[model samples]
Target chain A: MKREKVVVEKIVETFGLTKRYGRQTVVDRLDLTVSQGEIFGFLGPNGAGKTTTLLMLLGLTEPTSGYAQVLGLDPRRWPLEVKSSVGYLAENMGVYGDLTAYQSLAFIGDLNHINGLSQAIYEALDLVGLSEVAHKKTGQFSRGMRQRLGLAEVLIKNPKLVFLDEPTLGLDPDGIATMLELIERLPAEKGLTVVLSSHLLHLVSRVAHRVAILDRGRLMAVGPLEELAAHAGVSADLEQVYRYFFKNHSQVLSEATR
Target chain B: MKAIIRKELADHFGSTRFMLLMSLVFMISFLGVFLAGQGIREVLAGGGGYLLRDRTFLLLFTAPGAFMPLTAIMALFGPLVGLILGFDAINRERNQGTLSKILAQPVYRDEVILGKYLAGLITIGVLLTALFLILTGLGMTGVGLVPTIGELARLAIFWLMSVVYLGFWLGLAILASIAFRSVATSALAAAVVWILLGFFVPVLGQTAAAALTPLEDPARPRAEELAAYDHVSRLFSLASPPALFGEAAVIMLDPTHRGSEQALRLSTMSRLDRLLLNRFQGVLSVAQSLILAIPDLLVLIAFSLATFLGSYLVFVKQEVRSA
Candidate 1:
């Protein structure tokens, strides 16, 4: 929390960002913004459009109708530019089992056209605490190690912003703590903006400066935890704030049906 | 794109399945060539130089041996290599959840597919070249005859065509990989396509051709009927890649094989005229052989490009799910 110079520049912005697969709207009209140097959390359960929205922002999937900007570049028009600057750790992301950790990072480094590749790979692996097994095949890695390798893959590119989707999905407690610590250090130590998406409320609250609660492709509430909790008339705990919004949303849905 | 191509090449070359498949192809080819060489040696020993014919060096590939010629074996099983290399190209990545990770980078969708297809093509080219070189070495030692420059040129052209022929299968397998979600489904689909096009379609072509143009006199069909049968059968067989490869390979490998229709027309010629025609049919120069085989070459290239383009379009437009 270095707040010496508080210049809130919007790192990501979207207006009416909607994504529909045929008749189903996976992501509805949504306006959102993330400032530079903050961990933005996208909190939603499975099939709630969290992953879909992340894909749209990364320009991996085109939005049905709407606009998205990543690092001041329109994602649809400048996908490569946006992607080059933004690292994305997709949900359930995996590594080549046959490839050693070093080889895997080397491939990513090559893709990003990183100069001094060997040095970069070493730094990335060391940062994720995976240097001990750099030569070991990734197929032998545990779930936590693989997840950490995925993070190393992101950091190897030295991206200005990173989108991490359920990065600790199947990790043990120790693994989760290590992953969180790595994430928590990104903003301050590396000047990276992180947009972390997960359904785990407490973990997100631990690292994310702001969280956006979504349900059924719609944004329910978004703000700092204290601000959101205050708005929802609940205590400043993410779990309580999340329940407050979700309960009201369900009631609103039932009323609309009636 | 270069990075992707390099990575895919490493994967294809290092995989155990690829090693097994390569060895299988090697053993089959070695057996075929060895048998052909023994048959050639016996003829040469019996002072049957006339029977051995021109382009004797090329006989190592086209001569019948161990149930089938080396060319026939290639036409049948070369596709398996391509199919195995590409059947799970995209889907396996999607299944392992690595596709999204790669796509999320600065790499374009087309680059991914194009790199994969190129890697597969390069692998096929290397495999075919190495196989041919080894067979040629065996032929030199066994037949005790050095290949003339003309024989060498024809061998080179045949090798290039084989690469393209197998490249078509690689493209089709990649298309299957992109179209199907599950790796198992794509693998099954590729195998099914290989069987349908390689074995079933050629047989079906013969059946359809016979049905379309039945000889009025089965015991001794008229020349016109024979010509009609040849024309109709060739037309049907051309629909299959293996048949295309086989037909084109004949003209490229055997200089004296003028054309299928030409051979059938000889049946209508007077006995003396047929004899003269057979004698004068002489070995075609490599340039002439290439000119004759251009149509098949173009078609094979088109088939390969079309399948690859199909995969590209499907992949670019398809939504990438993060699984």
Candidate 2:
């Protein structure tokens, strides 16, 4: 007897989404889907339009053309609704420098209209393992501490979909392991669907069920880690598969130009 | 929203910025009062001489001028506070990658903007009110001078006018914050705009009006010339809050005195002698107060709305990630 495949419940869908700044196209025409209860990793190199793409999906930035829907609502027209259902952690993940860890969490909880905000704040602090220093001002916090606080802020609301952009960028090895554990636990523990972007293929492969590789403003490749590795004719190492794909594509483009 | 406002007030009061602002306010107000008191004391000690009499009137007129230096200081820093408070209102969250986190909950963008603006306004309102109370307290304690009902009425109008004045700068700051990506750039942009609107534009307006309608003979008895001067002066003065505030304060302080020879001549005539003194019997009605107040209110509202709407539009169009 075969276990049933979880039906893909689309949480986010985009059709021909494009974004341009001045004369430069940042996110070219692209179609994408994020299913409910999946940790989807958006893998990209520097300036690969990962952040820009996520911003358009989050309705924080408008697309030049095409449509985006988050939780079945057009992002442009119903941004507030889309935002309400989605949790986003950007690249920098700045906490209110002046606010204490506890105070920052409380403020964000209040903004989100979260009930039992004090308790929620404490719980979030504990989850991030910053409970001991929750009262310390974020300005005094280390980069890893700020990153944890940023994650705590997102978790405070218990969002349905979480967007984490380089969430563990500045964390130490221990912090990274803690964050990875937290991310892995989220989908099962809270029924959350996460869409995180990172250049770290190993990290992405460990947690994400499905992955989309972005190069420049275009989609380079996408699939499950194992399938993508097999397709690249490499060992079951996501990093090696990613490098191989990119290397071959660039080599092909160079040869074609010659 | 209320929670946001409470948090903002807490943050403002907790920050060193509020302490600096309070100190500045106290310093300016104390200086104004001390100067006024010294000038008055000197005139009284001079024993009713002609110069003393003229100086008493000048001292009263000059009370409004004290607000000028204070207004300049406020204009310089007001936008700085607005930019600092609001520039990162959305972008910092994006940069910190918390924008999505906050938005994922049940909050609206309008609520965020409204909450932030409300917090800023509340902080400013509390600061201004505290300053007003301090001034009133000092006046009562130091000089044994309790403002009369009429004077109190004028002070209220002056306080009300300040909201508009501050609102203009606040709106500009918000616009700058939305337009720029960095807080430093926003602060600089707002300061430049402040200097232009608060100082340069008003001076330009005065110069243009002066060139258009040069000052006529001060000794002239021509009513039309005097009316043109008054109209032009009032119109030019409307370009700056300090000028508008000064005019409003003057009207409130001495509603019957319109800087006319008639008011001066009437000052010399006794109440019973007024019947005999037909030359000094030009009655200054309450109608003049209404006329003066109406324009001041309209101009303040118009400028406040322009700045507010401009800021709102910019905020609405702003990309969260840009900041």
Candidate 3:
């Protein structure tokens, strides 16, 4: 059963994935898998290499060593093909401030060589609840609006999978709720697999079907919340499970550095 | 790439920097025309309209600088226009957090840098075209001098030369933007290079020549010694882009300019004396002048291409995630 799952329908698979800068490894020998139409939360403390791993998967950065396949395509060998099929909303993603929201989406559409962009652009905007402000310049947008616009940009390509990095950073309470709701609904409504990386364990626990805990560039744990919680001999609380692993794994980091 | 180019062109045209710089250029162009017109008025008064009948209408560009001529002004200040337009092209995108987003899109890596550069080039082309048309129109209306077909073609050639000259600076600015992370740092770096090439380099060339080949009796050196001194000075200045472009423009615009005797390989004095014996032969033929400026033009083009390729390689090889 596990072999069938591994070979048949996995959307993301990385084997011994590693990234190093000079002598310091930022992502170390990570083996991970994400099935289609699942919310995979990537949990980490600061400097845990979450963003670097995402960059490697998206072909923005190359791994020092390892094999990664996204949606059955190798990012290193076929980046454009991978990019066309997978959407990525980078941490602190930027919009062209002088461009109207509609224009920005259309620009992304053009980059992807998407034909008949007007309807797709409008649909994407509608999905993000920014339809009313479609013609407004992005410079005048609030933080929430910009994030939504970014979501619209990601959605315009209609990819099978999306990677959203810290999508709720700097958002207000209401904005956070909106962004989280959007991410949660993407799998059910759009049939899109998602990899969401963030430090907010509570939020990830609420929205993600499975969670991976990372610390110091290593995959500390990866599984459903209850499974990981039970394995750690803790209650099915993501914070407890994360803390249990963090406390255990932080020593490995210090030893490696030493 | 087309989308990027369209967006960049819109941004540059709508920008306050382009507007401010273009207005400055516009004002300077008008002032140049006014100054040249006043000089022409005195000439026409002294020698009548028949005196300039045989001269090409493009002579306004190479007009002897009673005040600084238009080509001279462009040579001096054109780098500012191109530099300001391009210095912040990539770094601003990086700072605003847009560069990574663009890179993440499904396009080849060179598309972004190439599109931005093409946009800058197109913007410059438009500005120069407008300036050329305006200057030609003003010459016709204000001074009642209409260019012949050959003269118009020469003007077009000069316009193209101007673009190539300024493009070298634009490419340098883009390279600086890609190499540096901060907009301020890139702009300052580009400006400093511009200042060196535009002002300091030529001055340094003169100082270097004086230091190396000091003439004890500086007032009246022998002909061969003076020629040698000029040759040494020219050699030093050749490293400067403005000096190269300046020599090319002067030669291309004024057909009578055979080139500096000390720097040029061929002595044109005999040819000039032979041509002067014929009343209608004060200037070299158009083909001859083009041949004279070909080497200068080739050098300018080669430098522009080198800088452009340098920027291209830097941009393609850079790590976008670092931004």
What C-alpha lDDT do the candidate models reach, one value each?
0.89, 0.69, 0.85
Model 2 per-residue lDDT tens digits across residues B1-323 = 66557776787779786787667666765676556655555655776364331123323323433343333434444444444555555445555545555444455555555666777776667777887777667656654445555555555655655655666566566666556666678778777766776667677766675676665665653555555544565566677654555455455445554543344444555777777776543423335554655666677668767766776677667665633
Docking class of 1: high
Candidate 2 Cα outliers beyond 4 Å, as residue runs: A1-6, A248-258, B41-113, B215-226, B229-233, B257-291
TM-scores computed on chain B for all candidates:
0.95, 0.74, 0.90
lDDT at position A131, candidate 2: 99
Off by over 4 Å in 3: A1-8, A250-258, B48-56, B64-66, B261-282
Residue-level lDDT tens digits of model 1 in A161-234 = 99999998999999999999999999998899999999999999999999898898988888888888777778
Q: Chain B TM-score in candidate 3, rounded to 2 decimals? A: 0.90
Question: Lowest-scoring 10 consecutive residues by lDDT in candidate 2 chain B?
Answer: B52-61
Write the residue-wise lDDT of candidate 3 on B1-323 in tens digits: 99899889999899998889889988987788667866776777787655443254666776753667888888888898889989988888888888888888898777887898889988999999998899888888887788877677677888888998888888899999999988899999999998888889889878877777777687876555556666777886677888888888887777677678523433324666546655654666667778888888898889888888889888876777644
Query: What would the per-residue lDDT of candidate 3 be over residues A68-149, giving only the tens digit for each residue?
Result: 9999899999999999988888888887888999999989999998888999999999999999999999999999999999
Angstrom error of the Cα, residue A108, model 2: value is: 0.9
Interface root mean square deviation per prediction: 0.6, 3.2, 0.9
Q: Which candidate leads the pack in DockQ? A: 1
Query: DockQ of candidate 2?
Result: 0.43
Q: Which residue ranges in model 1 land beyond 4 Å of their true spot?
A: A1-6, A250-258, B51-54, B266-280
Cα lDDT of model 1 overall?
0.89
Q: What ranking emerges by lDDT with the best candidate at the front?
A: 1, 3, 2
